[model samples]
Target: MFRSIVKQKIPFLDLKIQHQQIKNEIFQAFEKVYENTSFSGGAFVEEFEKDFAEFCRTDYAIGVNNGTSALHLAMIALGIGEGDEVIIPANTFIATAWGVSYTGAKPVFVDCTADTWQIDPSKVEEKITPATKAIIGVHLYGQPFDVEGVSSICKRHKLFLLEDAAQAQGAKYENIPVGGFGEMGCFSFYPGKNLGACGEAGGITTNNKDYYNELQRLRNHGCKERYYHDILGYNMRMGGLEAASLGVKIKYLQGWNQRRKEIAKKYHNGINNPAIKMQSQPDWADSVYHLFVIVTKNRENLMEYLNKQNIFPGLHYPVPCHLQKAYTHLGYKKGDCLNAEYLSNHCLSLPMYSELTDENVEYIIEVLNAYDDE
Candidate 1:
């Protein structure tokens, strides 16, 4: 018998509800931008950048068009280019690799730890060589990777460390926030992220003033003064309209992140299925639970069961970066990154938004715990 304890459908993500709560505030912010006519990179974007820098506990934050552009600009500012290699985890979204590829640098893949599903620092050193210029440590799934471990390796090898903090807006490692952990950190304010803008937006955070200046110029067509181009650059600047919306959303980020954590705790404590596995959190890292993922060998069956109960889940990624067709020229094989491949096959993301109701969570747990693929 199919259990229908919960009558309402639970979506994997409901950005609409989040927008409704702050609709008026968002409109007001937009009105201000409209009145000032700061449609492009102007006062509104500058204000949000300042606000974001303080929130991340960093000295500066440079706003950009999107997360991918933020990464690309950072790599350019760091002088990463053709023939250079940047180490990245294989289990990440392709945008992480895009940053390196855009700069004509090769992205060397590393396997994630089996338990934490984060870049395994143990595997990083083996991939580094004379051609390696930097290491982009992604705080995958809103959890901080082994910062000390990765930082130690960077120090020993004299490589630049960049934090891909797109999913970890409020996450921290040992009480220090993620964005300021490396030489530069990149963030995305995609509509579904914890602190999302109304439209596309992203930022780079750093303490280095020189990197800050370069990033600003790079994002705005390589010019500090109007119409005086210093170098070749793209039109990757963030709009004032998107930045204005982000300013309103940033205030409630902590509270929303806390609710996500509460839901994750319920899932952890309630699910008793023998076949299911979850990412293990480290003591030193505080995760914001951007995606509450569970791994099961019987993913297809579990997904079908959840769908029948009017619960729609999601997949963070079904393919690892190394296995993507775009990277085929790099000559990577299936068994190269075993951990990432296993996760790509087995991972399932459940409904994980701040707006997820308690009844929805309990019903999900009920359905999951009752499942028996045997």
Candidate 2:
């Protein structure tokens, strides 16, 4: 059965209602694109890049097809290639690992912080080597990773720092946005993201002139002029349509993120069950609560019970990248990634979005508490 008809049920990341609210504005953006017939990189994309770069407090923001492509382009722009190594957290989505692999660089898996589920800064130096060229820090669940600690480690070892800010559109680390701290930051605008566009879209932000210029060329067949390929490149440009939609959505991002934070605060204070552990934030960081996840002992049972009540939840990285069959060449055996394994088994995402009704959130918590009461 379809979910919209179901009454009083919390659905995980409802884009339908969100889209409904902004439909007219979104259509106007599309209409502008249709009027100009400028479907590729044009005024819309450039204006969005400028606006987003300003929002992220970076010198440049280069739009692309998806977060994966953005990451790939960053690695390419940085000239990280075969025989190189890129260290990344084992707990992130597979795209983080694949992005490194896309450039023929090896992915060195690092352990996660038990509390934050981000790359443990203390464990970073141990993974560095002569081949370790870059470190990709993922801001998991819209929480900023420890950029201060991570950047210090990277500087000491002379490694590039890349921010996977896919889930962290409005997140901040010590009053600075998550993307601003890294050498380059990549953001995804997939429908489920906090600052989602109408479809798959992403961008890279950077302060380096070389990287910013290189990213522009990299996304457009390595050409400043049409039909020209200066270097080997791929087609990963963000369409004008997507950019138009994103530009419209970008206007409301901060307010929506604030709303998400409000919802997370409510969830934090209201879920009084011992069986569930809410995701905690560090004092120095401000998370946008993209997922509103929890750690539960009986996660599978809780998921099924919620689903029975027409409430749908989400799972971010049910399997860690290090343990995947494709990455078996990395020789990661079971228990090698201790914290990631623990998180993979225990983490479960609750219904979280800008439009989540208060009654639905309370009722969802009630159901979980009732389950625990048993």
Candidate 3:
């Protein structure tokens, strides 16, 4: 007699569970926004900006519409424009490059390190030319990149250094927060981010008063005062509702990040598959594990097997930005970024969230260890 196997359904990320945990506080924040009618950038946005600045240990924070807008404003404030070249990791999201492109600058691609899957600082100098204006180091999947090496390169080359801390809200390197390491760090408050808002939101952290003031104007049609436009800009201001939601979520960020770390530890200890290659975390990095990625040559089969077991996973990016159809004009070929191309083919993101239970993690690990190429 044949018997049916029972499968436990696991989601890649369960935002509903997280919402239920903080539903009361979130609703109360919404009520306050309603009472004040602070729909545009107002007191709510200002309060969250203050809180986020203190949280990131920076002198100033300016909230914007989204991470892309934040990056765009940063590029403008730093005086990057047409004919300028900005170096960025080839494996990162296209938004990083989009920010540079929006400012009429070309994005120069650099290969990522194999072990850390971060921008290879050793390859940076070779890409620099007279047009090189900045170097963007992305803290991919919550792990802080080699800030020291990248910062040294920036200093020696007299280029601006920017940190794309979109995936690493509470992560740290050498005990300093990731957002405070560069001249300006950009953060995303997308619904799935560590410190997410109800809707889209983003911000920038900087110690330079002039940069801060310029960013403030840039996000609001370049208006320092009502009816006074100082420079041409976009309507990239953050809404009060999103700001209020973020305010409520920020208070729980540290604890949530700690929980995520605990979950990552369990995944590290439980999944002992020879085919799986986990990301390496450096001693100086305290990653929040936004997405627990595993690399395997048999990614397609593994994803299929997990689906059969009712477990869903994800791919951080199946296509590297350099090889995307949108960037064909840049004249990049398949072999331009070897490590990033390798990663794009093999990387798989497992279920990772603060709300995931031990039972869920163990079951997922068991299934992963049980996968067979046959």
Clashing pairs for model 1 are none
Q: Give each model's clash number.
A: 0, 0, 0
lDDT of 2 by residue, 139-218 (tens): 98999998988999989999999999999997999888878777899999987899988888999999899898889889
Cα displacement (angstroms), candidate 1, residue 72, comes to 0.4
Report the C-alpha lDDT of model 3 over 1-374, residue by residue, as the tens digit. Answer: 11223355788888999999999999999999999999889999999999999998999999999999989999999999999999999989899999999999999999998989999999999999999999999999999999999999999999999999999998999999988888899999999998999999999999999999999899998899977998997799999999999999999999999999999999899889888999898899999998888899889999998898888998989999999888899999999999999999999999999998887887888888887766
Q: Could you tell me the TM-score of candidate 2?
A: 0.96
On residues 167-239, what C-alpha lDDT tens digit does candidate 1 reach at each position?
Answer: 9999999988899989999999988888888999999999999999999889888899989999887899999
By descending TM-score, how would the candidates be arranged?
1, 3, 2
Question: Candidate 2: global Cα-lDDT?
Answer: 0.88
Query: Global lDDT of each model?
Result: 0.93, 0.88, 0.92
Clashing residue pairs in candidate 3 are: none
Number of the top lDDT candidate: 1
lDDT of 2 at 336: 78
| Highest-scoring model, TM-score | 1
TM-score against native, each model:
0.99, 0.96, 0.98
RMSD of each: 1.0, 2.7, 1.9
